[model samples]
Target: MDTTKKLPLEMVYHWESSSPDSLYMTQPIGHGKVVEYTWGRAVNEARRMAAYLKSLNLPEKSRIGLISKNCAHWIMTDWAIWMAGHVSVPLYPTLNADTVNYILNHAECDVLFVGKLDDWDMMKPGVPESVRCISYPLSPSNNFETWDDIVAKYPPLEGRVERDPDEMATIVYTSGSTGRPKGVMLSFNNMAFAAAGGIETLGVGPSERMLSYLPLAHVFERTFVELGSLYSGFQLYFAESLDTFVQDLQRARPTLFLSVPRLWVKFQHGVLQKLPKEKLERLLKIPVLNKVIKKKVLKGLGLDKVKLAGSGSAPLSNDVLDWYRNLGLELLEGYGMSENFAYSHMNKPGRTRTGYVGESLPGVETKISEQGEVLVKSPASMMGYYKDDEKSREAFTEDGFLKTGDKGEIDEMGRLKLTGRIKEIFKTSKGKYIAPAPIENKLMSHAAIEMVCVSGANQTQPHALVVLGEEIRPKAADEAFRKELEESFKSLIKDINKTVDPHEQLAFITVVSDEWSIENSFLTPTLKLKRNVVEDAYQARVDSWYAKKQPVIWQ
Candidate 1:
């Protein structure tokens, strides 16, 4: 109903208007103790934290760093920073000490709030001398002021600090797979618009429950999990850790869930582990048995409670989507980048597409350029690259549309199927253009596959680098497993070749180690494979493949 641009102040107003006793955060406090906060209490804490931040007398729009995992106090502190007229710079809790230093120094942060101090000791060497540090509400060894103490010392201001919608609100540092970190400046309206769009498309409401496990430092999680909750008045719950994700899932039984493709793929693998592919296929052939099994699977996965489930940040395999559909859960694919607040395109509930990233959300416009790159015009688009006007100029069109680096085609149903990254499409010496994503997706469709990247840069034919599923192991240290992998790759190649032109057919397959991961920088935080990195790592043997013109199996 709010047509005007939004600010964090508006959220406080809405929270105050809601039922005071509604649950806000449900998380284990300490030593397996569960604690919950009500909407009224959350708002009050945010107000007090806002007041404490303002008491520091920092300049308007001063950058404040928040180093924390996903938790109740993290969101409160973020809103407090903006409410106090400062910009928030969130750092991932699990980041390497070097990255933490890089982000803090790059943002020139004036203050740092440390949450979950277990890793803070390792990160302390990175904090600049100029910045002040404080711990969260519970650090008992506390020499520094705790969040609660600070709030008590400085109560909420008489009135809110009004802000313009276009003003810079947060500086999010993106550690893209191939490049150094870049600070992305997003306006208050960018986040607000994204949350609004999600609410409209998904019908988020006060009655809905959300489980917040993704890193809050990531733009996707900050916008979809945090801001969207504020907009819809949904109850948000945080997982204690990866070990407790399933327990947290059962506790929350979230009505809406969002994840990257990797998790969905893992879920599919988990299901296939219990029920073999051929057995599942045969069961589906039986009418009554199929329905009963599907219902059971959905209920077991906690997806039966999901009114809406979406995948984004990376391309999801159609195999995973089809498997979920077999279990009666319609998992939709979404497409977005950090620069766009991660909600440009989404498969709206009831009107959905499996492989495509669905239609543009309400109030957003998208088009494919002559070069097949996606361009978007949306309220949720980033203001610009922080403190980098030259980079910003090149990132946007002359008319101001955000040029997404993705290549895609719009189907008759208005859904967009991403083919590949424009920069990632490889050109061979044979004057053939190859898109790797389609082939990579096909390879990952196997239950025993985990990660894959395709490359043919400056070569005669394309090749694929793959990782086996977590449960799958080589048949033997000998050539047995390698031979089985080769046969599997051949079968996959045959199927993928049928779906594409000759230029795009994969020529070689290499089964990579199962060690590639987001934390290891092999992938982006969103679990997207970095093709440039993968290709560079395997550059030594690349030319020999073209000379041989035969698929070489590498273990």
Candidate 2:
């Protein structure tokens, strides 16, 4: 298939002239305040920063590290990096010092841009003193040369800078659900093709307003949201913080929204907290009242204006998808990984299946490997893992289709249903191998259960560890609620086991005392469970727990 060399930088030049005064970005600056960046203003600032970046005299295509949460400057810095002919390497804002240090040194970054973050103090020590640091307006107190100073000192670059499509644009490190993250190299054409194709397929245009709360470091946000904006000239809004998400989202009133299953579940629980599930379901049976209640609920959650919505990064329970759909929201599930720039597959507006992640997008090919792994070929495929030839070589088949590492089944109509990760399958002592993802998803459907990880490798039968929902945990302290919750877990398990084969039945479920998070090294930045870490953490007590408890073991 033939593809254009049109790059995001070129798109910026287009918007600079075509719609110079359009609202390009809306960034929250705390204290109920916001700052707007018009297309002209964004381009002008990016060019000025490009001028400053050029002054640094770094080698051509040098890797510059960008560490920040989603913000206006984060996107601007990325554009500036391209305009200055450098490669950007963005680190997750929540990364530990060691990981931050490893990526910086591994990428051989000559400069680093420190943007808005909550853990700058912890991450700063990881940054090498040799690398030049540039601080953003919202950055923590640092002595580095400031972004404001650079914009004031240097004039915007003389002319619209153009980029060669094949040049390395950025090095995106995987979230590392299992091991150390690998830097995935993407070219200008790689990002441009992805942004352009997704825009055309999804019918995104200048009128589309999207909220950019997801980390731009990941391919999903960068390709779909950041670069998508450059391609479609959409108005992008930045969410300030987790505490003010509802208010911030309300302000943006995004026409399209994308979120993870975890957040979506939280939203469901948030709704259920105010109106019990039984009551809400009963009210929905009454036609007019149902519509009114749905509107009120969505408006309360700042999602009433969303014309299109998506859940990705992990598999969302069908129950939650149905819940949002019941509220008259068009929530679709998409399937893609960081390696493919998240352009692999997505459900269309009218052609959606409940559990399936949708058919392959136009200009994409998919096939099942002999081992049952999902393989894909897309125009937006990455250049391969940066500086890791062995791993890169192993990532694809001889025919060049990327080994997605996910096990899935494609229906006759071309829809894809992900079963589990090929690597996540574990064996029991009885010689039966079990896939935990599908089982974990069953328990995840219950509102009282927040996160579930099914484990028990080399044991008689596999079991699961679950963290109670935020609201459910406190209520569990009451003896009455505790008994009621245990009975429900028993029923949930019994129901789930009836669906799976006998060997795959869960032995018991342990209620984990603590929650998994990036900070705790139990979950990846994308919220995928670190299976190995989790298994190791609970290994010692595995035998003892089964002996003491009947079915639902409390940690």
Candidate 3:
């Protein structure tokens, strides 16, 4: 991988000119149909869009907002934004109107590109009348200037717009798991360095295939799927919808796959539903049967040909990691935040530590602060938080390392295991501190539980608020099911308490009926629990339940 490519567009042009007829990406349109694009065609379409954007004659470095789910058009729009010398501002498709308004206004966006939206009517109220609007492929309605009309009206862009290496390229907003989103300003050099380092570190090449289903608005997906494709010249595939995900995965057969821990857990649960745990264990003990079981499982999951698999965006349970490994799949866990362009750390291919996020990547530096916060310095680090000097200044240490707020420790081999967020650690009346994440991870392993939150704050002992899994939800009303769930949870809690310190042991478990979702403001777009929101919703109930002195409380 050549690090000399100064910009992402340069890499696009390289592939386009060198292998114009090679397949670049395929987008599922629906009804068992997919539209494929070659490198030359993709670049040409992007250039056409860039020509239209240039015709607008907007001010230099003007902010352009892109709101959509993952698709081929999303990448085209992003490339067009940079090609026209504008800064791209991406919004999650799941964002509410208020957040959309806030981010668009805060970013001072002059134009908005809408594509493949779930609810455009709900989002339209947030777009200012002054901001120009454009519609892209697969748009539900022709309410805005259509992408086809613009391309037909304008010629291809004459040449690449000149940009300084340090010039702002994009402003990616954080997923606000803790609070309101803040825009993280990334420069051309930031992305250039990250793309180069990632390609070299992961050993991705032109022949590698990737499926893009994760929200492209998030830096994790953007860095690995979008930027990785450009730098490595890999073929990219897009999932049409959740209903067709399995079919899409089977079609793509991605060589490099990345997913969050939640999805990985869901996959494990899906497999367990087909093959009971005891049966799986017994088969693994037989040498010949283990290979048959492994091959069948991988093929069913559409991961039979996957060369590398990774989980990030949240901590993965070591149990989940080991389960996949038993099936001959090594699921590497990585660690990074939006502030650093997700360039901090990753588990290398051959050297993986089950529970730990791997060592710092090349061109990156990591250290533990006196307060145990993970600090990172890398060429890919964001320039600053856009339009917020005070917050940006507070984000970094005096020596310029980004303060990653996550509490963690590095082992002798330099693998880092995060304990929890500094603000998330709570203290009990016994005056002992407890990290909720590890405890929550343990509780989530129970087959009946889908999500768990541990809180004690001002109480004598911490208790958990859990949401029942989908498989167990309908059975909750049956007497036998209820009795079984109670026993399972009780046994799970007792087993967890034996392994943890006294202060960290959960006192009781309160099972809730309501499902937690992004629409309900309980989870972020990335599917991470909004801890503050969860605590606020259940803290009082937790206090009341703790006073009852029952081992299990069902709501």
Candidate 4:
């Protein structure tokens, strides 16, 4: 509620120090009780870890590889790496072994930090024989040192590293949905500026609680969860696993929640499944019934408690937004990229439009270029791509604005309505340009549709490949049921076609029984559908399905 002023980093730390006995970071996985690390405890551990890292005698600004899920120790290790005057290279824990090796060797890490060892055997092959890997919380491994031992051996430093705000702090490797991952170099000031801006805009205070499940390796989570929590003195709880996500959510009951669009789509589908399509449609037809339906659905998702919920990393459909807005939860869809520290534009709760990504964050400027590309200038923009000066040059304009790659137009209200990606646009035979993301988002927002891709590179018009939702798989599996599902998609596509130009209209829709998955290379770790790969894999089948001039089911 204190919109008048924003707290500084020193002030945030001072608040934390004042509550030395208050909980800082917590996890319930191994600890008998919810593992609580206080402000004093965290400071001590971070200092000792820093001292231990400093004793390694690595070169100044040496790259340190961090491969782990979200955990309290990850933060401590990051601080230690920073205090030792090294640059942190955060890798997605779900990345393949070969990719992991490529990133590890690419960074040429002097040391590696391990937490939540999921694929130890696969990951071990990639680690250089000479590179020392220290696992957090100590495990039975001759090659690794324990955190407790490292802290006990080295004393905490009297002062933290006097970092130059402009100096590189971390090199975050993107999930590389299209190609080999490139590390995006970011500075302390880049991250710190975004943290301050987000805290100010979102009103994050010491009283807020945040649950950490999204991979901290991603800049989106890193900025919002790691830096935001650290600078705001907020209590952070790490979820044990995907299986216990709901349990962890109930336990934390966070005030502020951030999620990707895929999760929001899933939540929307869950509500629809309970009410069913015909019944919900019938209910919505009546004004009084619509209000009652909205109230019941919002309360069921446990999102009723959320003061502010955000969807980002991918665009969310208007239908999903409307579903949540009907409830009391003010679900805002934000738009940003890793190069921008993942905080650029967000829809403020009270002020928002249906299709817009909302206004720019504080101290951030947004403009649409002549080519319709969204360009942003912000203090939080990354320094440059790591070791890729040419690529870095291409990412920014001559005037120092960061090209967002997304094509969009901003309204007078300052809301950014995304049209499509510059590269993702397809040209039909009629010479008309079709943006597939918006169309794909519409199909995906359907209750029965889990994932959808719209493409028609060399065709007359575009078509869609849709994956059926998990809950309705059995019902949709039967031939009779398949026909019903197909008809539903046909009607949905017809409606979608009405909204787009003739060349951009979908000619047919193909239903895929199996969902596209991250592990299968169809999606990125952040759950963004890898458009190229998905289209390539289903291209032949798509052609065959479309040739039928009817909805076709693919098992």
Candidate 5:
């Protein structure tokens, strides 16, 4: 793949001039209502925004904060920021006040662009009085300049602002599960390489369609949805709300779809709700009937048109991957981190490995460190962690490979199978180290389990804290439900223990009543479980759970 390509702003200009009337984005505003933006209109709006920012006469390369959900204006604001010669800092829409304040202050942002959000009241206190503010379609409760008024007031900026490929473009903050978020500085060249390589690897084109529902702040979504659309000229659709997700997906009929492991699991559960797993599996065995069944299932889920389906941001279970394959969808699993712009490795179509995050992309290098850490060297690697010289130095090796902090082994085929995070491995009282991720992945395959955390620390044996799936919660009070759950879990545990080392065997399963969510601090905005938070909340009860002398304990 060619590492040198036009930057994002250049692509915007190219598309604006070549495909002025072409649909760039379709945004859902309300029930059965949508607002479309053509390439010409989007560029004109961004130019106006750039003029307004230039009028303020901020310093060159000033840091600007963008906080919002996925929308047309969000992408427009990003382009405008770059066009105005400023750096973009994106904040997760679900972030709390403390983290929000930390990012704004640490990045030293001169202005903020607020857009459609769920909880502005929770985020308002974080914005400093010194920083100027601009609101998008929806304004925050605090008085601030609105996007409409600014565009109406300023004429579109004349002439394109030239930018070097190596210049800084955005500071992407990691969604930290254990500590404070770190800002990863990405340059235009880095993003250009990633976008170009991704297009080559995925074979997406201008005619491709996609539904953009994931948080735009996440690197996976930002690179795939925002940058991918700009480079490929694909039609982008935005979901109106969570309530309208199914309708939105149906309307778009996307040719490419991406989702995290949790959402994939939910998709499986939703299917099983209508057809029992056993019956579905049996029906899938019939030669002629299987085609009909698969078509029906895919059409019902609004993924019948998907040409490429992917799962990332975390490890996906082989069980889930196989289930999707059984329905005629090749669910590919890829691996990357915020530090690499998510360009490390991906499973190519028709050449996928069941359990590995496929071969490294073209022009990307990967090797296992002496301590079994996956290290990568690629054009898409970040410049460094912003404002943290020590961390930036520690992240790379003497040879310049970025230390991924993930323990893994490369196969003969050069595929990477991640074992677990080095720091997440725990020692049991029996003096054996146990990697919890593999066990958690296995437990999560159970129909009733939504999320699971395995921990032993200094205990006799490792045990799991399980959160019941949404479908099982309502029936929890019934004796029949309890009996069914006990039977299912007993068989599940027995089967799982048979495949693991003796030391890694689970002692018991503790089912918790509470749901894990971002609001409660149990999950990150990306929907990854916070193991530290989970252990802190339930460590004291581990002994009590073991003392019950039962295989299953309901809390």
Candidate 6:
């Protein structure tokens, strides 16, 4: 586990000396073009960038903003920031101008590193003119100082540089599903403890491969993929774009693949697009054919080499897990939040519950609060929120456990089954409280449904708003297809309703055509639904939909 309290930059130096020529990262540039970086070269570049950053002569421990999509340089820039004695502040690549302006000003950033983005034009204005901007390779514009220019202008930092374990490392802002995002400050000690524990517990090594596609701004990607690389030295691959994601996966052939619930569902839907679910299930019953079918399906998705698959950021349907399991894949679920460096509970091999998030990792302590909220205490827990003393004080217990807003239950086996968020639970007019998560998971089992939100506080009965999968969108023009879908959803709702209490039962399921996305502010960067934005968009019309007395209503 290498429990020595070493910062990430020191670990990078260790790896540079230990295995300098080892391939560290592969980045796809465009059509059939790639760039590979050895550990030595990667560190040399980071060192040079660090030298350039030092040349700016910024104050010690300054906040440096990095707004970039996933790329090899994104990782290097982060290392350079840490190496240059500054705290890195990563902003979500998909954020709008307002958010970009808000974060840079809020963090009091002095320099901004811009890299690989689709919305650089929209986000460019938000970067404060005073905050010196540096552009990475493959960046959309040439307006800012280029990374190559700086690297070519300076030499690599001569001697070894390191930060104290207690030094502030980074400030990761929340996804703002609750409200305005809060900056969660984490120290080098927190990162070290998390990386050491997670890598040792997972038994990952340098030989393993991983594809990094999720936003690096999120804590999960930062804590696991980024830091785990320093601790375990696994080779990483950067995806080019959405159009080439499949090819990128095929190129990497990642042995360890982690994804969110939304992408997992999309992948399944992609498979079902070619083959009917009923026919696939029927063929799986035959032993030899089932093997061939699973192999072909997995290979098509480029997940054939995956030894460990994972889903997180939100609750996933058990059916999705079961589908992957039936194909002999080890898909596990984990539970954690930004405040804890995302080093908390993870379902382990041979000790897993299908729907539960599984037991705590070696150093994580978990318990249910009086309000059924999940409270966690771990070595990876954040120092506190930056510039918000009141919220920071409110976020933890008197004894120092971080109050995870999630509502969960622990079984005898210590498995944690999250029900919903304490803030998400609402009461019906009948005075019975409803936790929408379980019901929503049950409803998501239907293959045609993409996203579902269960809501109706103070109403007679709870209702649901569902976004249909893309697979059915083409068929929607056909009257027969639409009728069949409404009937299918009606049956799905009737079946699910029988399992929950009457108050928790959904009065109707409405199919909404509105897209929920980060651009629209309907979803967070991690694809978590922003409940407030969602309801506010349609709450005024919901009463009329309810009065229609239809089992499945369409909007």
Predicted structure with the largest lDDT when compared to the true one: 5
Model 1 Cα displacement at 216 (Å)?
1.8
Roughly what TM-score does model 1 have, to 2 decimal places?
0.94
Over 1-555, each residue of candidate 6 has an lDDT whose tens digit, in order, gives 464467788889988899999999998989789999999999999999999999889999999999989999999999999889999999999988888898999999999999999988888888888999999888997688999999998899878877888878999998899677899999999988888887887888888999999998998888789998888899999999999998999999999999999999999999988998999999999987988999999999999999888888899999989988887887889988899888899999888898899889888888888988899998789999999999999999999999998998999999999988888889988999998889999988988999999999878999999998877777876899999998999899889988898778889999998888888999998999999899899989988987899998888
Each model's Cα RMSD: 2.4, 1.5, 1.1, 2.8, 1.3, 1.0
Off by over 4 Å in 2: 1-5
- Assess each prediction's global lDDT (C-alpha) against the native: 0.79, 0.89, 0.89, 0.80, 0.91, 0.90
Candidate 4 weakest lDDT stretch, 10 residues: 3-12
Looking at model 2, the pairs that clash are none
- Weakest lDDT window of 10 consecutive positions for candidate 6: 1-10
What clash count does candidate 1 reach?
Answer: 0
Model 5 TM-score (2 dp) = 0.98
Pairs of residues clashing in candidate 4: none
Ranking by lDDT: 5, 6, 2, 3, 4, 1
Clash count for each candidate, listed in order shown: 0, 0, 0, 0, 0, 0
Q: At residue 282, give the lDDT of candidate 6.
A: 92
lDDT of 3 at 551: 87
The regions of model 4 sitting more than 4 angstroms off are 1-16, 30-33, 138-143, 277-300, 553-555
Error of 5 at 471 (Å): 1.7
Candidate 1 lDDT over residue span 283-376, tens digit each? 9889989888887776666666987887777888888887777677788887777798886888866777767889988888888999999998
Which lDDT tens digits does candidate 5 get at residues 1-555? 232478888898889889999998999888599999999999999999999999999999999999999999999999999999999999999999999999999999999998889999998899898999998875446578999889999999989787888999999999999899999999999898888888888878899999998899999998888999887889999988888899999989999999999999999999999998999999999998999999999999999999999889999888889999989999988888899888888988888888788889888999998888999999899999999999999999999999998999888888889999999999998789998988998998887888889988998889999998898898988999899999889889899999999999988998999889999999999999999999999878878888898988989
Per-residue C-alpha lDDT of model 2 across residues 1-555, encoded as one tens digit per residue: 112457788888888887888789999998999999999999899999999999889999999999999999999999899899899999998999999999999999999999999989888889998999999999999899999999998999978777788888899999998778999988888787788888888887789889999888888888789988888778999998899998999999999899989989999999999999999999999987988999999999898889989988999988888888989997988888778888899999988888899989878899998899999998778889999999999999999999999999999889999999998899999999999988988888888999989988888898999999888888888989988988999999999999999999988989887878888999888777898988899889999977765789888
Query: How big is the positional error of residue 473 in model 2, measured in Å on the Cα after superposition?
Result: 1.6
